[model samples]
Structure formats: C-alpha cells, structure tokens
Target: MAYSYYAYTPSHTAALVFAILFSITNAATVAQWIRYRAWVWLVMVVAGFMESLGYIVRTVSTKNPDKKGLFVAQFCLIVLAPVLMAAACYVIFGRIVYRVVPVESRTTKFLWVPPGFITTIFVTCDIVALLLQLGGAVLVSGTQPTQSNVQQRIQTGKNIALAGLAIQIACFGFFSIIALRFHFISKQFDKRLADKTTDETTEDEKYIMVNETQRKVLKNWRPLLRVINVACILILIRSIYRVCDFALGKSGYLEQHEWPAYVFDAAMMLPTLAIFVYWHPGKYLPYLGFRLPKSRRENL
Candidate 1:
C-alpha cells in the first residue's frame, strides 16, 4: 500500500492564497533590494522566493495528494525557507550593531562576537540546522507505508528533524539574549550622551552625531532594531510549533489538523516577510557607495 502524503487533504484555496501573498511580498522585497542595493537583504529575498515557491508547490500537491515527490518538495521548501529568514535576521542584527554602536566605545566587542562575525556565526549554525532538517525530511518522505521498517524509518527521520529544530530553538534563544543585552547597553549609552553638556564631546558622542546624520538618509536604527526583534520572536514561535509538529508524529493532532499548520507556520511566516518589507533594512542601513557629507566625515 502507498503512504498517504498528507494527514488531511491539502487545501488548494489556502495554498494558492498564500502563494500569491508570498509572491507579492517577494516582489516587494526584490524591489526594495534593487532600490537600496542592500546586499545583506539578499538572504531575505531568497527566503521570500522559497516561501512563494513552497506554497505554489503546495497548491499543486492538492491536485495529487498521493504523489510523494510533490509532498517532499513542498515540505522541504516550507520547512527550510524559514532558516534563510533566520539567517537574514542574524545578518540584520549584525548590521544594526555596526551602524548604531560607536566603534570608539569598544562596546562592539562586548557583543561576545564582533558585529562582522555575527552573521558568520549564527548563519553557519542556521545552515547546519537547515541541512539536518532537509536530510530528515527526505528520509521521512522516502519511506513507504507498507514497508516492514516504515515506522522505524519515520522515527529516525523525525529524530533528525527534531534535532534540527532543537538547535534552531537554542540559537534563537541565545540570539534573543544577545539582542536584549545590546538594547540595554544602547539605552545606557544614549542616556549618558543626553546627560552630558560639555562642549568637549567624547568619541562616542561624535559617533552619535554621525548616526543622526545617517538617520536622515536611512531609517532610524532604534525602530529598525525593534522590527528585527519582532521578526525574531515570530520565527521563534514558528520554530517551536515545528518542534511540536515533528515530535507529535504524522498521526499527531497538529499533523491531522491543517489549520494549526496555517495558523502557526503559514500565518506566522507571512508576517515575518511582510514586516521586513515594511521596515526594510535596505531603507535603514547604509549601503555600498553611500557617503556621509564632507562636514560629517571630517568630524569623525
């Protein structure tokens, strides 16, 4: 006997709707990237593309629910796409640190990792998680329902996927702590700057003047950090939902009910993309060839 690819019949309407939604956001992000040329956002653009493609594949899967290939394609795309979004988040935070924090204060070093290395560290971890989840998804989707070892294979696959999800959760949790720490430190720095009334300015105070100048061209770093924090929380929530999903197995309540997947995964991820588009880093971060006024440059 063939395995049922889905616990419930996939809904074409729902899939199509999301496909269109993601596509729109993807296009908007692409335009934002082009307009601002913020290359760091490239990962986010890829995530949006994968999201649209995932939903598109899901829409197709509704027509042939028994096709394992279609099932695996949609599953892998949907599951791994968020990893890219997570990677983008890591990069965004790093960029924010570089742009907002004064290098003269040496607070950048206090981040436990340098701003430049933040993307390298977290995104590398995210890749490991992505690969693990991809391998597990393929393994689980490859199994035949009638095979004697089917349950064992499914169990093994779920274990691997769970391991990936666990890593994601840990990474997100640590990343959140780091972000919170940075937020507090930044607040303190801002407060100290405000309290000082000397004509003689500290290097950190000079950096704030430059930041204010940049703010005229780019979105304010403070609000951008808040946007990033919200996006991070959304991704964490989705990751937790995925952990429960794979742990519960195919017959699990979340698996059996399609609504939860939409509510927790699809609905949650849509805003993750949409929020970025609204407060696009490209609009906020200084891009290549962007120059500060000669007066501001001379001040530094």
Candidate 2:
C-alpha cells in the first residue's frame, strides 16, 4: 500500500515549543530592525519569519500527520530558511571588510564594487540553492500514490536538494578564505602602525601615535568580526549536518531521526540568529564609515 503520510511524525510538544520560540525571535528581530531602521536586516527578518511559520506548520503536521500539504510546506520552509540566513552572514563579511580592510590592503580596490559586491555573489548563490531545493520539494510533494514511485520521487528530490546545498557549502568555503585573508591583512596593518610609532614610547605621546583612531578602529573591529564569524561557523556546521542528512536518504539514521535534526539544525540555527539579534552590526558599523543608505540615514 502507498504511504499515507510521512514515515515519521514529529512530536507535537516539541514542535509547539520550537514554534513559540521562533515566533518570539522573529518578532524581536523585526522590532529591532524597525527601531534601528536597519533595512539590511530585511533578509534575516524574512528568514526568521519563515522559520516561525515552518515550526507552526510542523506543529500542525504533528496533529494531522497525514496532511501532506502541511508536511511539504513545513519541510520546504525550514529547508530554505537557512539559505537566507547564510546570505545575511555573507553580507556581514562585506560590511566588516569595508570597514576594517583598507582599500590599499585589499587585492584590488574595485574588487568589492557597488560596496557589497562580494556579499551579492553569495546572495546569488543562496538564491540558486533556494530555487533548487524548492523545486525539488514541489516535485516530491506531487509524487504518485504508488509506494515505489513515491519513494523514487522523494529520492530524486533529495538528490536535487543535495546538489543545491553543495553549491552553498562551496560558496561558504570560498568566503571563509577571503575572511581569513582580511584578518591577516589587518594584522599586517597593525604591525606597520606599531613600527612607525615605535619612537613615540612616552605615555603622554597622544599626537605622536600615528593613526591612533585607526588602531582603535581595528580594536573595535575584531570583537564584532569575531562574533559574526562564530555565527558563520554555526551556520556552516548546520549546513554540513543537513548535507549529511540528505546524503543518507530517507532510511538513513540522520534522516529518520528527529533528535538529530533538532540538535543539528534547529538548535544550531537558533543561536546563529540570536548572536545577530544581540550584536547587530548596524548600530556600531556607522562609526567606521559603513553607513546605512542615505534615505535610512535621515531617519537615524
């Protein structure tokens, strides 16, 4: 007989808990974005909103496990939400690079044209991934009633989703290398600044300290970059966990088990967004010349 519902159903209590949490988080992010007028947060806000909706649907699916529509909507929303989160992190790197990495220190002055061109590349990749995964889910959702046919379609969809996630992983890896390069460049600049001011050893030598503001800027830069990078690592780990799940297919341990998905995907994602909620770059980045759009700037 053809399967009537998902092979496994999520726990209603657990889904409800997650749904509430995600809703609260999304609301808080939206409020913060409005207060700060950080329109850049629109991407993350949408992702968070999707997450909340997904978990709500997940809760509904728990009550009616045979509702294929609910299952498909939840699965697709949850799967694509992180793609947006990843794009937000990519933009953060561009903002930090613009502020901290001097034009001369960069490989090419125009490398990140239109301000956040590097971030734009990552966003484009994310959109590609989102489309593939969404297409795959739509295909699987419409599979025939025959058990074998349904399984086959599901597998095919999984494969497509896996391909998209792989591209995202590659983009993230390349972006990491660029971020590390910026770190080294900043260190080199700091060293040069110290050497130039070596003779100004006196405690009262404020004026003698070459580029004091620049050095202070770097100091501020490190903590914010470190926090966002940590968030990036969390998202990367979540993606790898998902890629493994897709590779294992429906019968695999990671795919069959709810706990692993909760731990690796939901738990990891929660804090990744939380970090940005607490440490929004928009509040601090303006001082470093990474100003919001002039139209938004007027409101601030």
Candidate 3:
C-alpha cells in the first residue's frame, strides 16, 4: 500500500536540469566508489542509486502528472534513501578522523569526551527515527483521508524525516570540526613525513584507507567535496522541502510556486552535476590504482 497522495507535475526546465545533474553525479560518485570500494561506499552506492532513481521518477512525474503511484513511489524512495547515504557518510567519518589524525594525538574525536561514542548515539537515534517514518507511511493507506489518524501518520512521517535531517546535519557539523583538525594534522604530518619521503611500498599500504585522499590533491576539495557536500545538502533539503510541498498541496498553493521546481532541478541538481563534470578524475587511477583497471583511466 502507498502512503503519499500528492501527484507532481514536471517542470520542463527543472527536470532537464535535474536529469543532467543526476546523470553527471551518478558517474562521479560511481567513480568514487569504484576506487574506495570500502563497505561504506557500497552502501553509499545503493543509497545514491535510489536517490538518482527518485530524480528520475520526478522526471516521470513531469510527463504524467496524474500518475499518483509514480509520484508516491518517487517521493518515498527519493526522500528516504539519501538519509541512509548520509548515514554511510557518517560512518566513513570516524575512520577518516582516526586515520588522518593519529589517535594518540587526536583531540577532535574525543574533544567532547565520549568522542565517536557520541556519534554512535546520534546514529542510533536517526535509525529509530527513519524506521518510524517508514512504518508510519504504511498506515497512511488504511486511514481515511481526512481522519485524524491519517493526519497524524503524515505528520509523524514528515517529523521523523525532519529529525533525521537535523541530526545528520549536526553530525556533519561535528565532522567538519574533526576535518578541520584533520587539516591541521595534515599540515603537521606533511612537515614530519615530508622529511622521510614517501615510498610506494611498505606497511602504509596495510592500514591506508582509500577514502582519505582528498578528491584530488592538486585540485583541492572545493569541487569534489562540494558535489558530495551538496549531495548531502540536497538530500537534507529535499526532506524539508517535501514537508512544505506536501503541506502546501493540502492548502492549494504548491502548483503556483515555481521556486520549488527551480530550486530542486536547477539550483540544486545542476551544480551537483557540474561537480562530477568538472572533477571526473579520468586521468588519475583510484583504489590503490589496482581495484580499477588501466583501461578505465584516460592517463594524466
């Protein structure tokens, strides 16, 4: 049984924009995952595929505005899926922090005393919140449209999504702090490790995590991180935006507002795609340069 009742229309402009963006991001992140191949990246791929399908579904929504089932499926999958991806990103952060900054000298991980433990607590809460949202959606089909029960379920689902986004954002904030510490640690490391010179062989390979390298060393994180960062933001923003879009649908104002469509497809999706378009590392080999074959690279 489906939950959401709203049907969406395609904004030709927005859909085109989102389509182009999704196609691009899809390639970049896939490239990212191919090299990393870390368990978390696998999870991220599932989540990313689902999110991309959501945008595709939105494109479907544009062509046939009356297809309620398509609308509901896209909304549920697209909206809920990204949170899980963000969760995977959350999991990646701990190891990343531990790696870039050695635990002995690390202040950021345990800066608040409990360290990664605190994030674990938040992850647990977010999971419960996500489950509740999924469970609540199930009840929607059985409840009368105007009944208090139906209203309660809708509100519960939206609230749960909101809670998840809020916590994830908070998690990002903490991670950013740790990443800052990582930056400082990197500087300190460069000073120390620089004197020793890097070797292509040895034990560094044993513990070296694939995700730690900034998207590109020389290009900087501004672009790659921006794509991924915005990817997370889009996931978060999509959640809050849905609540308003749905609420406004009930009140009868959603169709008239062009901003919703524009922001989502163009403002949000395009820049994200551009990240992939601009940062595609065809020249650089990933996953220790072995997980992917030589044929896959274009040569630097």
Candidate 4:
C-alpha cells in the first residue's frame, strides 16, 4: 500500500486568495515599472511574475493533490522567487547608500564595501542558494512507491535546501544590520549638525533651516529607507520559516500543512511586493544619481 503522509489536499479557497493577491501585486508592479521607466526593477518584476505563477500552480494543485508535476512546479517557483526579490532589494539599497549617505558618516570602507560590491556578493550568494534549492527539489521529485532510494534522495535534497535558506537568512540579516547602522550614524551626524546650526542662527534663519531640512529628508531618503527595511524584514521572516520547514524533514508540521505555506510564504511575501508599489525604487533612483544621458533624458 502506498503511504500518504503530509501530502494532503490543498485548500481551494486558500489557493484562490493567493492567486488574487499575487495577481493584483503583479499588475501594480508592472504599472510602476512602465510609468517610471524603471528598467532596473526588471528583477523585481520577474520575482513578482514568478510569485503569481507559483500561486496559480498552487491553485491547480488544490484540485489534484496527487499531481506530482503541479507540486514540483509550485515548489520551485515559490522557493526561488524571493531570492530575486532580495537581490533587487540589495541593489536598490546599495545604490541608495552610495548616493545619499555621506562618505564620512558611513562606518564601512567606501572603497571595499561599496554598494556595488555588497550587491555583487549577496546576489552571487542568492544565485548559489537558489540553485541549491532548485537542485534539491529536483532530486526529491523522484519520491514514489517503486523508488527504493526515494527517502534518501528526499532527505539529502531537503538538507541542501535548508542550507540554501540559511545562507539567504544570513545574507539578509547581515545587510539589515549594515543598513540600520548606516541609518543611525547618518541621523546622529545630521542631528549634531542641526543642533550647532540652530544654536548659532537667528530665529528666522533657524525656521528656514529646519523647514528645508525636513523637506530634504522627507523627499530624499526617509520613505525609501523605511520601505526597504520593512520589505527586507518580511522576506527574512519568510526565509526563516522556510528554514524551519526544511529542518523538520519531509513530514514536518510546516511542510505537511498547506496553511503554513500560505501564511509564511504567501502572506509574508505579498506585503514585500506590495511595498514596492508605493515606494518603487524607480521613483527615487534619479535622486540616487542614476540618470539617463542628457540626450536620452531630453527625448523621454
């Protein structure tokens, strides 16, 4: 007799909800990309597309739990999609730090820890992590009654996937610390300067100075900083959940239950994507020194 374990039937309602959510997010993201000419955010667009597709696959799987192909497709897409989103976040934050943050305020070595270097290292790691996860999924897809080594292959693949998730969590966590440090140092430096200037200036001068400062910070860096941090944290949590799921082995509570996947994966990832709709990096990249050539700018 074939043993049926954590491979329970998926909920139709849950799949539908994710499908709708991802679709809406995808449309909004595409609109943002088009309106802003944010070609750089193509990676994010690809991530959203994968997420939508994964949910749609999940929706199909709900109707047929025994369909191995549906399970594998959804598995690969959902697991790897966030890697691309995290990469996009790294690129955006790196550019923001390089352009907006004063060289003196940054604790990291500007030459070695430049945004480009940080982005490159993390993105490379994300690619490696993604490949490891996908490879694991492939290896585990052979689980069937007739397959003698199915359990071994599945266990090995799960371990590889867990390692990948760990790497992702570590990368995101390290970058979050770096980002928070830079934010704190810059704000502290700005505050001290403001205090000295206000003490020395006349009332009228102080008012103008304070007003201008507020406008500058609000318009330039604050919103992007908040959105990026929140998005990263959300994805980090989702990655951590995935790590636990894999850690539990094949029959783990999280892995066996469809609801956990919906909550940790879908709910967590949706907000991360939605955050970009309002604070699309394209809207602020121009302020970060990213620009088209004069001729191109004029034509647009």
Which one wins on TM-score? 1
lDDT per residue, candidate 1, 154-213, as tens digits? 999999999998988898779987887787777755554344324444433222344344
Best by lDDT: 1
If candidate 2 were superposed on the true structure by all CA atoms, what would the RMSD be? 6.0
Question: Could you give candidate 2's per-residue lDDT for residues 1-300 as a string of tens digits?
Answer: 434455566688988998999998888888878776677768899999999999999999888876778888898888889889888877777766655445554444434334446777888988998898788766765465666778878888888888888998888766666665566556655554344444434442211232342222222446556766687787789889989887887678985678887898889888877777777765556432334334221111
**What are the Cα lDDT values of the candidates?**
0.79, 0.71, 0.49, 0.73
> Which lDDT tens digits does candidate 4 get at residues 81-183?
9989998888787766654544454334632355336778888888988988888766665466568887788889888888788888887888777776666
lDDT for model 1: 0.79
Task: Flag the better candidate by TM-score, 1 or 2.
Answer: 1
> What is candidate 3's lDDT per residue for 243-268, written digit by digit as tens?
45544434446535556645653354
Q: Total backbone clashes of model 3?
A: 1
| Candidate 2 residue pairs that clash | none
Clashing pairs in 4: none
The list of candidate 1 runs beyond 4 A from truth reads 1-3, 104-109, 114-116, 191-217, 288-300
Candidates, ranked, lDDT: 1, 4, 2, 3
Report the C-alpha displacement of residue 32, candidate 4, in angstroms.
0.1
RMSD (Å) of each candidate, 1 decimal: 5.1, 6.0, 8.1, 6.3
